[model samples]
Every structure is written in structure tokens, then in C-alpha cells.
Target: MRSDLCSLLGIEKPIFSAPMGGAAGPDLVASVCNAGAYGVIPLWGKPVDQVAAGIDQIRALTDRRFAVNLNLSFAYEDALEACIQAGVHGVSLFWGMEPSAIARAKAGGLVVMSSVGSVAEGQAAEAAGADIIIAQGWEAGGHVWGQVSTMALVPAMVDAVGVPVVAAGGIADGRGMAAAFMLGASGVWIGTRFLASREATIHPDYLTHVLGASEAQTEWYHDLYDVAWPNAPHRALSNSTARAWRDAGAAPPGQRPNEHEIIGTRPGGDPVVRYQSYTPLPGTTGDVEAMSLWAGQGVALVREVQGAAEIVDEIFDEAMTCLAGGPGKPGPN
Candidate 1:
């Protein structure tokens, strides 16, 4: 099923793999694009040369459509320049909104997508010339924008914006994909569900924690702390770090535990920090318990690690069956 988005990007399916920073690799992105879906590489914190190298790697693997994700809150100009140099097919912006940035991307003949958390933001994005708007609800993992659920946010975005809407957050299976389409989204951008796949470069320990987690396992630390993502909810597996923060009354400003110290590795490879986002915890080896696990509520739906191509094919096949008024069976090889 092709929507305006699919045709614009020259893809057969509207499903787009999120540019999961740190975790998403060239092989993973290429695998998705080769399967007739759009894959995105996160360009956060990477230098221009490194970003170009990653783009070159993906280009070498597949000649299909793909994109680069630019977190506007970061150094976006560098990311945009690298994407342009690498000849990316499209670009997606997150964190903050930038109309001029979108315009520049469009002027370069690249499709542009932006993530929005509210109706006003969605309308503004459309008015600013964003080709597509992604309604990212609070249930989404990683850094979040606001506190709206996808069910309520998607329809509102569709109504507010003339551009096509893509529903994100809490969507994992074919049923959720159909529900998003029913809710007026032309496409779906998934993250946590795909993060559990084998192609993802996250630590195996982190993946295991995701598999064993429940919806209630995630909580918001912003309410009790003065973090950068304050008031913005983030879904992650509950761990000692979280419990300690909660028990310590969220810690005073200077008292707040240092993320890099607690989560980062020590000099000379000492095992001081316990977790470091994507990397596995030091000394734990294959043990999954002593790490930080980032995931969405959709973790409940991910039971196994499959190839990226297979995962995309399964989701699309099941979604097509559902749209055809047939039982949406699980994707099989």
C-alpha cells in the first residue's frame, strides 16, 4: 500500500524505520531499505566526515531510498551539510522545529519530515513546509516532546495539518499499524519494536531487559528531577539507577548523580560506570541485568530477534492482510 509519502520516497510501504541514534547502523538501515521501506540513520553528535562515511556505507549496501535524521536541538547545520554531501534521499528532524531548515532540505530536493507532539506544532510544521509530520506521543522512548498519547495526537495532527501524518510511540504490531492508519496517519515510524531486532547494534543485555519488561516497568524521572527533558516523559526499564533517584527525592541540583560518571566508562577501561546507553555494561559480559534498557510500552509485543528485512516484510504483510479484511497473522519467513 503506497501513500503520497511512499510515492514521494519511491518506496512500496509507508513503514519507516526510526533513525535510532547509536543503535541504528548502516547494515540495519540498508536492510530495511532493501526490503522496500525507508531506513534512517541518526546523525546526532557525529562529525561531518564520520556521517559521510556512514552514508557511504549504506549506499554501498543498497541503492534503495533512505534518509538521515537530524536532531534540531543539536548541531543540525553540520548534519544537514553531511547529508547533502552524502546525497541522502530525505531528512527527518526531531527535538525542536525549524522551518528554514525544512525549506533548505526541500530546496535540495530531499523529502523532509518533522516530529511534533501537539496540534499547534503539527500545524506549524505543515505551514513551515514540512512534507510529513510525525505525531510522537509520550509513550515513545528516548527524548520525548510532550505528554500526549498517540491515539489522541494522531487524529488531531491529521486535522490540523494538510501534510500527511505518521503516528509514532506505542506502535509495534500489525494491529497497531492498522489502528494508526484508521486514526488518519498515512504511515508509521517505529523505534523500540525495531530496536529489539538482531540488526540493531544495541547490547544484547539491553535487548534482554526489554524482552523481560512490562508496560508498568517504565516511569518518568522528570517529575522528581530537573533534567533537560523535564516534564517530558521517557519510557525505560526500571533499574537501580532509577530507584536510587526516586528514593533520594530526585537529588538536589549539584547532588544529582552524574550521568556520565554513573553511566559512562572510566579512564583506562576501569569498570566504574554501570551502563552507557548503547554499550553493554563493563564486567557483566553477557549479563543483561546490570545495564540500562531503553524501550517503549510496545516492548510487550516484541518476543524475538529477527532479521531487519524479515521484520519489515512481516509488518507490511500483516498490515496488508488486515487492510484486506483478513486475519492479521504474525509475520512468518
Candidate 2:
């Protein structure tokens, strides 16, 4: 079962814990890597010092391979420097792609993984020196890259790129992992499924909402004119806030609740409510409703909040069983 991806990342399993940015903590990341799966810490919008500190913390916890995610749209330079200085195992860049940044990361002897939306984007990333290219389909949580689904995107990128292809979006279980591998993906990156885990630092209420949500409960808000996310599509739970916006004919940006206001509480013992101001929600403080509840359609499959190590072990075990035949069943002799 060893592919180029497993060899390159030095992981026994082809699963990689996605960099959930503010939600992914050192314990969670370290735990995943310790479980023989790779873990990534999202470094979007954080100060270089903070990023360095976080990386240091993970390093102190585990000697296993791990990655630091760079949101290219923000202050990527500082983030890149932090990764280099901290001696991170690898770097994953999402959103916009920068060839020079990729070169710099690779020059520092760090493995580089880039996320793209389309086959063309995957090719470009490979050309730009990406060691691994993740094809993120529209069904993915957080910010989706392209309008295509994982089924279509995975094979396309595999054909177009020379580097290892990692499939993302709506993949949670071993069944999905087997499908991705069948489609030519060297590995898979999981986000939403891990988000519901006990290691995830999200608010309990938020986790509850995801666990209780049905497949139909999730909606693509980026399709609405009022909720565009630059080049990415976002899949989220349709809540009162989203419905109100849709019902109000998608009010102008200034008129709506600011992200910070929606997820943040006011001073003086005010109840926690959605931000009504213009500022975005501060990074990863667990204001469930205020911040974007980025999740995948696969959320319906998540039933409980288990430890990260337990969850990783279960996913790998289930995937191996499924690949053989079905759970607890043997493959063809």
C-alpha cells in the first residue's frame, strides 16, 4: 500500500490530517503524526512569533513528520519564515499559489504540498515545484477550490500532474479513501471528519451541530451572491444566520452581521451572538456561530467525538478492511 505519498511523507498510512487553521492544536497535530498519519497546522493570518511558538510546541511533543499550512492570501512571507525557522517537516500552501514561495520552501529542504481546484491548477502547482498537489472539490468544507467534485477532479489531476495527487473534499471514511486510491490519488486529506473529533478545539455546540446535521443539512453558501469567498466555495451548516440572509434577499455586506459580531460575545455579560459589526471573527477562539462553520457533506457520517489517535486508527483499520473486502472480511486469495 506504499505509494509515493507515503514514502515522501514518511507515514505508514496515506491519510493526512488537514490543517484546520485555528481549530487544529499541537496535541491534535502531534497525535495524528504519532498515529503514523501526517498532521498539518493551519498558519493563516497568525503572527510569525505565534506560528513559531506553535510549531515549537508540536516539535517538543513529537519527533514525527508534520506540516504547517500557509494561507497564501495573507502574510505568507512571515508564515513561510516561521516554518523555515522552526524546522517544520513540510509546508502546505492553499488559496493562491506562488512559485517563488514554493521554491523558497523547497530550498529550505522542506517538502511542499499545494492545494488546487482544477486539473490545470494542479498542473501549475506541480510545475511550480509542488511535491504533492491536493485536488479540493466543491463538496469540501471551508474554502473549496474548484466547482468540480472529487470524483472528477482526482483522476483529472492524476493524469495532468507528475507529482503525487492527494484527494480532498467530502472524504471521511475508509470507503472514500479506497475510492480515492482507486481513482489514482496517492493519498487523502480529511478535514470535517477530524473536526468532529475530541482533539478538535471547536466549541461543543458547533461539534453537536455537525454531528446532528444530515447530508441535506449542509448548504453551499458561496453560490449566493451575498456570500462570495473570492476564489473558493464554502460549504457550511445552514443555520438561522444563513437563512436570514437568504430570506432578506442577501442584504448588503455592511448591513449584515460582521463575522466577529456573529461569533463573539459583547462585554458586560451580554449573551454570545453573531457579530453585527464589520470586523471578521478573530482567529479560532471558538465563537461557534460567529466564525464560519466550515464542514463537508461527509459530516453526516460523523457520530461521536473520539480522540484523534482512536479516530485515525479506526479510519485506517476500516480502510484496510474495506480494501480487502468489507469490514472484518478478507480479500481475494
Candidate 3:
């Protein structure tokens, strides 16, 4: 059954994949959308032409609806303009709230989805004209924005905002989606689970680690991987770099262990140093283990890699079953 959020965003399922940087490429995004769920592509901080091309690529892949996310933490005017010009169905603004940016996207006839970490931020985004609010909790993978857990934040955000609330962070399976619905969320915003999708551009080693990790394997950091995106809190799986930092008593940035060591190189020959906030995509070479391996607490639920469409279908079907029976009730055996 289509939720109000599904209708609002012109999709059949109230499931929106998190725009996990390079991993949320056109193929995966298209696959998710084609499965009747919404997908999001990350074009944050990308050049205007590249942003336009990404949207075009998605258009070529599927006629289904999707959104392009822009990190408000960086300079995004040009990229936002490209999204508006491309006539994309929606735009996700994260990291911080920008009313003018939201206004511009709305003015361009684009539905605006903004991610927030707190009740105050949710209210602010709504007041700024955000069409939907993605309440990102602390357990989310990648660059996280808030300190509250999903259980605590979703209901509060729902209570605080008039717009539809999408509960993000630590939600990977149908149970979490059902829980979100019980908490008054219009939908669920999932990221870490998608990392195991066959279409994700993740390194083999990174995928392996994610598959083997448990709910307790993830660690929340206050800017540990801060080479590029400093001062942002994030969640990542434990690795040698993390062990070193813990061994060193969680030293500060400038004094952290392996402060400036080159650990890997991007596909384009850009150097990736230790403690850098970079996901290990395919073609990246060097000490991949030392690079940032982002994963949410929900990684435990993601046992194997599947096609993006399969994942969308599985979660959506399971969620419909669980939601039908009510929370804590098992679906038909």
C-alpha cells in the first residue's frame, strides 16, 4: 500500500535509499526507483556539468522518480542550480539547513527533502519550506548530523514537523521500517544496507567487512576521518586506524596516530591519506583497510549482497507484511 509519502514523492513504496556518496551511482539509484521505491543520487559539491550528466544518466536508466542530494556543508549553489535546471523530481539537502536553497529548489518545482539531526532542526527545515524531513539519527553510517537515536528522534521529529518525516540512521530491514512507521515516520531512509547491494561501487574488501560486521562493530566518531570533511560526526566500522586511535587514547586530529600517512589512492590518482573521510570504491588501491569503511549499526542485518531491485522488493514486501500485522508480530510463516 502506498503511504502518503509515497504519493507525495510520486513513488509506490515509502522507501528512500540514502545517497551514500559514490556508492549511490546511477545504476543502483535507477534499480531502486524501478522497483517502485524512491532512490537518491549524491551530486553534492560536484561541478555543474557533472551534476547535469548524472541526472541525465538516471533519466536514461529509468523513468521512475528519484532525488539528487546536495551536502549543504559545502558550496552547492552551482550543483543545486543544475538539479533545478535538470528538472529532477526531488532534492535532498543535508548537513545543515539553507532556507534559500530550499526555496530555490521549491521555486524550481522540485520537491525538497532535508535531513536534520534534532527536533529544532526539523522544525527549522519545515519553516524553511522543506517538503519532507529526514530525521538522521546518530547510528547512521557516513557523515551523521545528530546525536539522538532513531527511536528517540523519529517520534519527536514527527511531533515537531507538519511535513512528512522520513526516519533515517540504523534502519536496514523491514523490522526497522515497521518500527519507524509505528513511530509516526512516513517512510524509512536506509543507507548502510544498500552498501551490500550488487550495484554499489564499494571495494570488495569493504563489502566483506560490512558483511561480517555485527551491530556492535560500528563506532561513532567526532571527526576522526576529517581530512576533507572536518568537524562532522560520522559512523564507520572498526579498522586498524580506529584501533590506533583508541590505542592512543583517542588522540586529537593534529596529534592522532598516522596523522598524514598516504594509505590509498583514488581511481583518478588522488592520494587518500589515513583518517580521511573517503569511502573505498572500486579501483581504489593501497591499504584499503586503513581508509574510511563507513557502515551503520544496521550493518548486522545485511548478510549478503543482492541486486538493488531485489533489496528494494525484499524490504518493501517484508515491511508491508510486518506493518499489516502491527509491530512485534511476525509475518506469515
Candidate 4:
């Protein structure tokens, strides 16, 4: 059941974990890679020292290939160079990147993948020499690049690009993956499902919200939380902060209530300021419920926490079953 994309990445599965900054830390990435699924860690806005250091940790954990990503919208050039030097198997470029930059990564012998919000963006990425193109939909959690659903965007990008297309957004289970394969996606990039896994370093409260909520509880719109990373539209679970902002008339950036308020702290005690675009991690306290509960529309399907490998195997079995024209179920194929 492997696709060319999996063969290109040398992974047994066609599932690529989303490079969720802050949430998808090195532990989760390494676990997924070791499990035979592609793992991606977001490197943008992180400390330069941590870029290679995180790769070191993953390398120590698993010898398998994995990827790191850069959100050009808030990237540090030096970090990009550092990743190239570290020799990660792949690098995902996002947020309207220049083709020359993708060329630079390719020159370093790094497999280049770019995320696109539109079919035109997919074409541009392919022209820019992206070896793989991730078609990110509006249903994806955290900061979204463009406004299109997976159902419509995947096939369009597949039609638009010559490279392999990876479908993202709203995909939470084997059913979604099978559907994506039918839509011409060479692979599927899953986020929220990984967020519910045991390897994720997010706050327990956040996990609780993900498990307890339904699909309708998740919402995507513009709000103040983007103050830390402005201009990028994101999708997340409806939490207290979202409710307050929504009730307060959904004010624009500058007019939002409690602007710059210090809401919580990082697990290591770093101050979590208002609108910081911070996803609650372990050891975090103070209004954890109010912090960004970023998740995909697939959050509804996320029922419980399991090891990363188990989640991968479960998804693999069900997706294979669906593709084989059988009823999707857990357990064995």
C-alpha cells in the first residue's frame, strides 16, 4: 500500500506527521519516525541552538530519516543554514517561500517539501523544485496558510503539481487517508491525531479537551491570538480565550480585549504572554483552558491517547482495509 512519496522518504507508511511547532517536539517526531511514519518538526521561531540540537536528540532515538520545517513568515536565516548543516533527511518550506530558497535546500542534498494553500501555490512549489508538496487545507489546526477544505484542495493540487501531493487538514483516521488516496494525494499529513498520542508534549488539559470535544467544537477564524504570529489565519478548538473574544464582538487585532496579558507559563516557567500563539505544553499552568487549543476539525475523531507507533499501526490497518474495499475497523487487518 506504499506510495511513491513513502518510497522517496524511505518510510514504510505514507503518513507524514505535521511539523507542529511547540506541540510536535523532537520526542514525538523521533517516535513517529521510529514507528516507520514520517515525522516533521517545525523549526521556525525556535532558538537557533535548538534546531540542530533537536535533530541530535531524534538521531539518538532513531536512525530513521525525518524532516524539519521552516515557516518563512517568521524564519531565522541562520537556523535554516543550521538545519542544512545538520543534514536532516527533509525540510518543509511554508508561507509563500521564494523558489531560490527551495533551490538552496536542494543544493545541500536535502529533500525539499513545501506546503501550499492553493492549487496555484502547489504549481509554484513544483516549479520552485519542491520534491514534495503538502496541500494544507483550512481545516488544519494552528496557523493555516490558505482558505480551502481538504476535500476540494487535495485533488486540485494533485492536478496542479507534477510532484507527489500530500494531503493535510481534517484527516484523522484511516477513512480520511483512504479518501485522500482516492483524491490523488500520494500521502497524508496528519496533525490532530498525533496531538492526541502519548508522545506529544502538550499539556494534559489540552489532551483532555481534544478527547472530550466533537468536530463542531473546533472553529477557524481571525482573532487576537495571532498577535505573536500576526497575519496568519489559524484553526483551533474553541476554548475560553476564543469564547471571550467571540463574545466580545470578535474585535480585530489592535482592538481585542486583554491585549498582551500574561496568561500562563511554559512548562519551564517562561512567561506566556497573551496572544503568544502558545500551545499549552506539559507542566504549564494558569488558564490552560484559555490557551490556544490548536487542533484540526479531525479533533472530533481523536478519542484517546496511545503510543505514536500504535496510532500509526492502527491508522495503517484501517486505511489499508478501506482501500481494499472493506469496513474500517480497529485491531488487526
Candidate 5:
């Protein structure tokens, strides 16, 4: 049974991949779209030209529709305009809400999806003309917005908004998707599970950590990785940097242990310091483990890496089985 939200987004499956920065590259996004599930490409903080190029890259890979996600915490007016000009299917906004931005996107004929942490935020986004509301819980990877859990936020958002609600954070397998649907989510927004997709561009070490982590291994932080991005609350695997900070009294930014130490370098020769909001990609060199390794509590269920299309099919099948009164496995096949 295809959800109305799926039809609205022009996809067959009601699964929307999270717009994970760096990891959600064109290949992964295209793979998900080709699988009839929605894909979201993270384009926040990039220049207008790069944004256009990124869209073009995805277009070259798949003819199916997908969205470009923008972090409102950063300047995104130009990038949003670029997506509008490129005739993309939709735009997902997160981190903050701006009615003007939503109005402008809607005016440009884009389906606007906004991520919120609470019922009040969902109502505000619906009022601001958001066609879809993504209720992100504290267990979500990367930058988390709200303090509530998915179990508590999904139904509240559905009841609070007139638009469709997409449940995010801590969802991994078919059991999780079925649970989200039971909680009144029209669709599920997944991030950590997709990190294990073969098409994802994350570093091998990062993938290793995701495949091995448990539900209790991830910890929520308030600006722990705040070199380029600050004042953002996020969830990532508890690693050396996190342990060091906690061991040293969980000091605030600038005073944290080894605050100025360079942990690695990006493919483009940019230095990556400890506690910086940087995902380790293939070309990254130097202490990769010490860098920020983002993952949700769903990491416990992501036990192996599989092709994006295969991953989508497995989850969809299992979710359908679960919805049809069968016992769906809690972890990946």
C-alpha cells in the first residue's frame, strides 16, 4: 500500500533517506530514487555553483525525482534558488524555520518539507506552508533538533499538523518502519541505516564503527563538534573525542581537551581538527577514528553493508510483511 505522501513526493515507497552531508553522495541518492524510495542530498553550506553541479550530478545518475536538503543554520538562499532554477522535485529544510524561506520555496513551485523537534514546531512549519513535517527525535544522528524521542514525537506531530508527518531518528529496519507507521507517520526518514549502504561515500573506518556499534554507544552532544558549526545539538557514536571531553569534565568549546589538534585532512586538502563537524570520506587521511563519527541508536540494527537498492527492497518487504500481521525481523537481513 503506497502512502499518499509517497505519491505526493512522486515515489513508490514511503521511505525517505536522510540528507546526510558528505555520505549521501549522488550515487547513494540516485540508488535510493531508482529503488522507488525518496532520496535526499545534503547541499547545505555549499556555493551556488556547487549546488547546481551537485543537482546535475544526481540528474545524470537517475531520472527519478529526489530532494536537496538545506541546513537553515547556514546561509542557503542562493542554494535554494539554484534548486528552484534546476527544477528539483523538493527541498527539505532543517535546524531552523523561516517562513520567508518556505514561502519563497513554495512560490517557486517546490514541495517544502521541514524538520522539527516538537509538536509546536510542527504546527509552526505547517502554518509556514510546509507540505511535510519531519519529526526528528533526540536519537537521530548528526545534528538533532528536538529533545523528544520518535515514539513520543511522531503521533504528536501528526495530531499537531495538517500536513504529512515523517518520523525520523533511531529507525533502522522493517520493524522500525512498521513501528513508525503505527505511530501515525506517513513515512519514515532514516539516516544511520543508510550509512551502511554500499553506495555511501563514508570512510571504511566510519562504516566499520557503524556496523559494530550498539544502541547505547551513541551519545547526544551540545556543540561537541563545533569547529565550523556551533551551537548545534547532535548525536554521534561515543568515541575518543567524546570520551576525552567527558573525562575532562565535558568542557565547553575552546576549552575542551586537544581543541586545536588537527585530526585529519579532507580530500581537498582542508585540515580537519578534533571536534570538527566533519565526516570521514574515502580520501580523508590521518586519525579518522578521532573525527566525528555520526550515527543513531539504529546503529545496533545496521549490521552489514549492502547496496542501496537492495537495502531499500529488504526494508520495504519487511515493513510490508509487518504491516500485514507478520513478524518482521528487527535487524537487516
Candidate 6:
């Protein structure tokens, strides 16, 4: 399991906690880093000062290295500048891999990483000076990158790009980690599993939803939960809001019923309209069931809410045990 990625990032394990927007907090990020795995903070939709403040808070908690990811699907030039000024150890760009931003991230003495949907995109990012590539399969939670499966995507990206490749999408447990290693990935990126961690402030009900959900219940669509951000494809559990639209012929965002209706309020007490990009955070009181429950096909494997340290160690140990057994053994997917 000792790879160049670990040496480059100064982490003990090849696991990375995906910078899930609106789900990951400073505590979870620091906890992942402290647990001998790399932690990435999601800098999407945040202002410069707020981004710097988050970096400072995480730095206060752990001296180990971590990375910050920006969703280039949205606006983020200022967020990159703030991360550079804050001296973040790394920067990962997702959605549309803006070449200039990756170059700037590299120029600022930060390890530049990119999340790509295809082998060509991975090659482009490497050509643009990215230090690593995250191959996001469609089975991943939240906004997915492409339609490929992890088994196929990871190997292709690894072969296409000169830099190290990290496998994401539909990966939640040690079996998945071992499977990723067999696929020739340098590491794995996990999201839904960590959302169940104690440090993450996700709503209790949301965690319950993930714990109880089957792979069949998770569906993918574009503009289904469009409010703050529109026309973007994502994976989420189909709730009342999503079902209502589906029953009505899956109308476009503008034609949906109760469009812009205030359905809930977050922990901050701000009114969140229906289909807006608001997760059921702690202290949120409203229709938590109807909020977009982003999860992956691998979510059915997530069984308990453990600390980040425990989760990392358990997964890594299991992966090693599985590898020690023999080659071509199917990991716990």
C-alpha cells in the first residue's frame, strides 16, 4: 500500500476523504488528516475570507497536510487565491477542470489535483500540470463526473495519465479499497461513509436514510433538485419532492410544482426553498425527508457511525488482509 501518492502527501494511507460540500466540516477534515489519511476541504461557493477562515481553523487542529477542492462547475477564482494566500498544502479542481486555475494552484506551491470523468480529461489535467487525478465514476454521490464505472474508469485513467490516479464513486469499505488497489489505483476517495462519521454535522435523519437505503433506491438525474444550481446532474435518493416531479412527467426546473417554495430552514435559521442545495444540517427544522439525500451505490455497505480515525484504520487493515490472502479475490464492494 506504500505508494508515491502517500509519500508526496505525507500521509500513511492512500485513502482520501472527498471534500463533500455542505456535508464536511472543519472537525471532520482535521480528523481525517490526523487519522493518517488525506483530508480535503470543499471550497465550493465560499467567499475568500470564509475560505481562509476555514483553512485557519483546520490548521489549528492538525499540523498534518490536507487539501482544498473547488468545484469549477461554479465560480471559484477568488477561492483559489484565498487558498494560496492561506498556504494550503494542495488544491483539487472538479467539474470543469479550469487549466489556468490548476496552473495557479501549482504556481502557489500547492499540489494540484483534478477530478476527471474520462481518460482524456485525466490526460488533459496532467498536461495542464495536475499532480494527481481522481477518477470519478457515475456510481459516486453528489455531482458525478461521468458515466463510467469504477472498475473500468480507474484502470483507464491510470494508464492514460502519467500521474497517480485515485479511484472514487461507489467505494465505501475495505473491500472497496482492496478492489481499488487491484484496479491499479494509487488510492481511493470516500464520501458517503464519512458523512456518517461522528465529526460531520449532517442531520441524524440523513445518516439514518443512508444507513437504511438500498442500492436500488439511489437514482441519478439532471436538474431534478435544481434550485441554487441548475442543469447539473447529481445522484440522490428519490424523496417526495423528487417523486412529485417524476410523477408529473419529470418536468423541467421552471415547470416544476411548488418551485421556489420555502420548505425548510437550516441550522442558521435561513429559509431554504424547495429543491435548493440545502442539506439537513444540525438544528435544521423542516422537511428533512424531502431534502436531497445525496448518496452512492456503495452506500448500502455503510452500517455504522464511527470516528474518522477508526474508519480509516479499519478500512486500511481490512484491505491489507484481503490483499494478503491472494490476487483476484473480490473485495467487499
My TM-score estimates for the predictions, one after another, are 0.89, 0.88, 0.97, 0.96, 0.98, 0.96
Which 10 successive residues of model 2 have the least lDDT summed?
275-284
Q: Give the lowest summed-lDDT range of ten residues in model 4.
A: 221-230
True-vs-predicted CA distance for residue 122, candidate 2, Å: 0.6
For model 2 the TM-score comes to 0.88
Off by over 4 Å in 1: 223-233, 257-291, 329-333
List, residue by residue over 47-87, the lDDT tens digit for candidate 5: 99999999999999999999999999899999999999999
By summed lDDT, which 10 consecutive residues of candidate 6 come out lowest? 324-333
Number of the top-ranking candidate, with lDDT as the measure: 5
| lDDT of each residue in 258-298, candidate 3, tens digit only | 78899889999999999998989999999998889999999
Better of 4 and 5 by lDDT: 5
Residue range 1-333, candidate 2, lDDT tens digits = 677788999999888889885568898899999999999988667788888888888989899999999888767887897788777889999988788889999988889999999988887778878899989988887767678999999998898888999999988888888888889999999998998777787766677788888877777765322232343456777776777677777765556544324345433334444522111223334355543566788888888888888888888887777787775334575
**Candidate 3 — which residues are off by over 4 angstroms?**
326-333
lDDT of 1 by residue, 1-333 (tens): 879978888999888888787678898899999999889888777888888888899999999989898878667797797787667888999888888888888887778889989999888888888888989988887666778999999998888888889999988888888888989999999988888777888766677777777888866445322233334345567777767666777764456455434443322354434334443422344334434566777878888888888988888888887888877764563
lDDT of 6 by residue, 106-154 (tens): 9999999899989989988999999999999999988887889888999
lDDT of 4: 0.86
Clashes of 1: 0
Per-residue lDDT for 204 in model 3?
96
Model 4 agreement with the true structure over 1-333: per-residue lDDT tens digits: 878987899999999889887788888888888889999988788788988888898899899999888888775577778888998899988887678879888998899999989988788878878999999999998888889999999998888778999999998899999999999999999999999888888899889999998989988867557757777778888877777887899888877778788888887888887666888888997888888889889888999899888888888888999999888765465
lDDT of each: 0.77, 0.78, 0.91, 0.86, 0.92, 0.87
Pick by TM-score: which candidate is best? 5
Candidate 2 residue pairs in clash (backbone atoms < 3 Å): 260-281, 261-274, 261-275, 262-274, 262-275, 262-290, 263-290
Model 6 lDDT at residue 169: 93
In model 3, the clashing pairs are: none
Q: Rank the candidates by lDDT, best first.
A: 5, 3, 6, 4, 2, 1
